[model samples]
Target: MNAKELHDKTPDQLREELASLKKESFNLRFQQATGQLENAAKIRAARRNAARVKTVLNQKAAAAATDAE
Candidate 1:
């Protein structure tokens, strides 16, 4: 939902959540097309959450890479 929550999750949990968010985004789009979605802001929120997940994953990967060097 937010960076604080995202950052607090363990790496494995973050990965799981990322996958779930992506799936939800896809469903949201489907609902939008079918005229079931009410709030447009939800799509934006989902997208932002997806990005937050990605940023955290990248940070972890980069940290690991730096440690190897």
Candidate 2:
């Protein structure tokens, strides 16, 4: 998912996406620990995706705060 796609989603939707990404990250880590992870690249991708979601969520929160002010 790209920033443009994430930007179109509401905060609630973003939160849900973040949660799922985190869950996936956890599973990836577990697989790695068990020496079953086939693709290490997925871990990096999941981390980056989570970061993107967090960045967007922060942007939305800041915008809301500014609007409130």
Candidate 3:
């Protein structure tokens, strides 16, 4: 779940990872609302991970655009 790991993945793989992270975040929120979540920090972690995936994806797209020029 580190930037280096994400940086090496293909865009499609990154998208999949982002999707799973978002799903996890949603489930975490649901658990918190029901007062069943053991660790609230997990929600924050998931959110940050999703952001990292998005950042990497954007960087890849930008790089591709630059290379195309």
Candidate 4:
């Protein structure tokens, strides 16, 4: 997923997506530790996706705070 797609989602939705991405990242790590991981690229993709979600969430929070002020 990209920032543009995440930007359209509400904070709650973005939070949910972030949760799922984190779960996937954990699973990928576990597979790697067990030497069962077939594709290492997934780990990088998951990390980047999680970061993108976080960035969007932070941006939303900052915007809300600014509006409140």
Q: Which candidate is the best by lDDT?
A: 2
Q: What lDDT is reached at residue 41 by model 1? A: 86
Q: What is the C-alpha RMSD of each candidate to the true structure, in Å?
A: 1.0, 0.4, 0.3, 0.5
lDDT of 4 by residue, 1-69 (tens): 778999999999999999999999999999999999999999999999999999999999999999999
The total number of steric clashes, by the backbone 3 Å criterion, in model 1 comes to 0
Two-way lDDT contest, 1 vs 3, winner: 3
Superposed model 1: Cα runs more than 4 Å off = none
Worst 10 residues of 1 by lDDT: 1-10
Could you give candidate 2's per-residue lDDT for residues 18-57 as a string of tens digits?
A: 9999999999999999999999999999999999999999
Overlapping backbone residue pairs in candidate 3 total: 0
Per-residue lDDT of model 3, residues 3-68, tens digit only: 999999999999999999999999999999999999999999999999999999999999999999
Candidate 4 accuracy as lDDT = 0.97
Segments of candidate 3 deviating more than 4 angstroms: none
Arranged by lDDT, best first: 2, 3, 4, 1
Each model's lDDT comes to 0.90, 0.99, 0.98, 0.97
**TM-score winner, 1 or 3:** 3
lDDT over C-alpha atoms for residue 40 of model 4: 100
